[model samples]
Target: MDQAIQGKIEEALKGLFTAVSMLQDAYPGKPFTPDGRLVGDIGEVVASLAYELTLNEGLTKHHDAVTDDGRNVQIKTTFGTSLTFPVHHVPDYYLGIRMNRDGSFEEIYNGPGHLIQAQLSGRKATKTGLHGGLMAMLKRINQQVPDSERIPKR
Candidate 1:
């Protein structure tokens, strides 16, 4: 289980980088920051999309970047359709950065409602019994799409 979670965290980080690059390309010269909230650049956006990594004896808070304005961004990444939701509500907006087999990235949006908002604002999105549902959903999505087209570089 530890290895699996670590692998997921590594994959998430790689994907986060790709998403950041895409955001930078899209925004051009705009400065991105990650302060209190992962706010600012595309990299920060990618960081925001990441999940909090829990290891054997440590907790890793994954985030994007911070700006002088004090706004944090959660960049949710995926390889396929932007229509897919998250396995957890750890982010604010779902910035879908679909990666191509040829080493390219595409940015898309899935909207922000329950996922990040609920967690950040002290709302509940699911119960303990329903935890497996997200894993199942992600697994199904993985089975449906080609590995080469997944957003992050896994």
Candidate 2:
């Protein structure tokens, strides 16, 4: 990873968490977690920088960015465990990561979308993808992907 870009991410995450901590401290019982679109957006930004991808204009549905070689990629990030893949909308590539509170992250999955699609298919369709299925299979699935197939980090 680029130290400069990682530093920027750490700075931004620190500030955001500091604010969330203050809010949580105010309400002693409730927890204030940074999730949803914020995490998704952060993942997209980090993935774009790390993989040197070109982010698509607006919300382009299934894919978020185009790789250097022009393959469409769907980026996924989670502060917690598991990601909900849209079964109906698989892209050319899929990148999944987990973000920690300290602004660090782990690449959970990165490979062809078919890998994920196979894991999520033949299940009940709902507004959300991968309900009870495929949650525990990411690491196992990611392992099958050869490193050469992944986009090289910048």
Candidate 3:
């Protein structure tokens, strides 16, 4: 990562935190959290930089970015404890990350798309609320992936 670009991103993140704090102070107990599309956008930006992905145009089908080696990837990001991938299409690979407060992120899952999907199969969220698999579960699945199968960052 370029230091100049990284420094700018860090500054922008600080500004975002400031805004979130201000909203919380003003609203008092009302949740003015950034999630859904906004959080997704942030995830894309972070993925493109940290993982060196070439981001696709707005809302492309299946995958969001392509790797340097031409692998299609669906990037998932969450600020909360869990992430839910869309049921429609799983890309060639999956990269799941958790955004931290300090503008850094923790990679939760980086492995084949099918593997992650397999974990979600036939489990009704309401049965035990499996609708959204938790991060801890994802982490365990991630361990099953071999390093050679993971997308390598340059």
TM-score of each: 0.29, 0.87, 0.88
Best by lDDT: 2
Score candidate 2 by lDDT.
0.81
How does candidate 2 fare on TM-score? 0.87
lDDT of 1 by residue, 32-82 (tens): 322222212322223334323211122223323222233233344334333
Residue pairs clashing, model 3? 125-129, 125-130, 125-131
Task: Give the winner by TM-score.
Answer: 3
Error in Å for residue 81 of model 3: 1.2
List the lowest-lDDT window of 10 residues for candidate 2: 127-136
Candidate ranking (TM-score, best to worst) = 3, 2, 1
Report lDDT (Cα) of residue 132, candidate 2: 31
Residues 1-154, candidate 2, lDDT per residue (tens digit)? 6788789989989899899889998997977877789999999888877786889987887889988888889888888886767755677898988888766778888889888778667677786554433446877888889988786687
Clashes of 3: 3
User: lDDT, candidate 3, residue 79?
Assistant: 82
